[model samples]
Target: MLVGDRGSVSAELVIAIPLVLFMLLAIVQFALWSHATHIAQAAAAQGLAACRAQDGTAADGQASAQQLLDELGRGPLTDTNVSANRTADSASIQITGMASMVIPLLHLPVHAEAAGPVERFVPDLAGGR
Candidate 1:
């Protein structure tokens, strides 16, 4: 508690505040990335499910993927979209999203993909005969 030490608190605050703010910004960015990833996964799953249920008349799987992305992506990933395609044996989906931050001038881009074969189950109405 000396007269010459009067500025120590101010100095400490000035340094600590920026550090804390930086960490918070980073955390927000991380959360946004995680949320975007989750939404992408969900979209992929929807696409796969739609492919499995396709009736051979239209490309419902692609529409399902896009719909899921639109519904799940908000906030940092609001401008995201999903792409999907189905081949003879399998279906695949991809997601695109972005995250922006003020500190350090950062804008993060996120992309992910998921794929699986169309599911099928043979009916055993003959009771294992």
Candidate 2:
């Protein structure tokens, strides 16, 4: 009988397999989280842009934000809240939502904000070379 060689490989596998699988799952979860975060930020930015647009009102911005959320997710969105604000020279939007993971029993709460200067430009209609 060997001192430490008997079934050593099996023992190592038993210990290492779960650890490796856990690490892989954690990485996958993190990637999902990061992607959700980006989607949240993008939704907020789209809302803010819509709010700042001259053709649309705040409700339009909110609707756009909701559309963005829908595009980023499968099934229906949960607990979505959206708002936008405008000043004499500035505009901003805030979006809050929760994204459910593809895997059961997993959910990620997302909150984001987007703001930019509100400017109206008038281009010269006259043809110039």
Residue 102 shift from truth in candidate 2, angstroms: 7.1
Q: Which tens-of-lDDT digit does each residue in 88-126 have in candidate 2?
A: 577788877666565457777878898877767768788
What TM-score would candidate 2 get against the native? 0.73
- Going through the candidates in the order shown, the clash numbers are 0, 0
- Candidate 1 stretches with Cα past 4 Å from truth are 54-58, 100-104, 120-128
How far does residue 12 in candidate 1 sit from its true spot (Å)?
Answer: 1.2
Stretches > 4 Å off in candidate 2: 1-4, 75-79, 102-107, 120-129
When summed lDDT is taken over every stretch of 10 residues in candidate 1, the lowest stretch is: 52-61
Highest lDDT among the candidates is held by which one?
A: 2
The all-Cα superposition gives candidate 2 an RMSD in Å to the true structure of 4.0
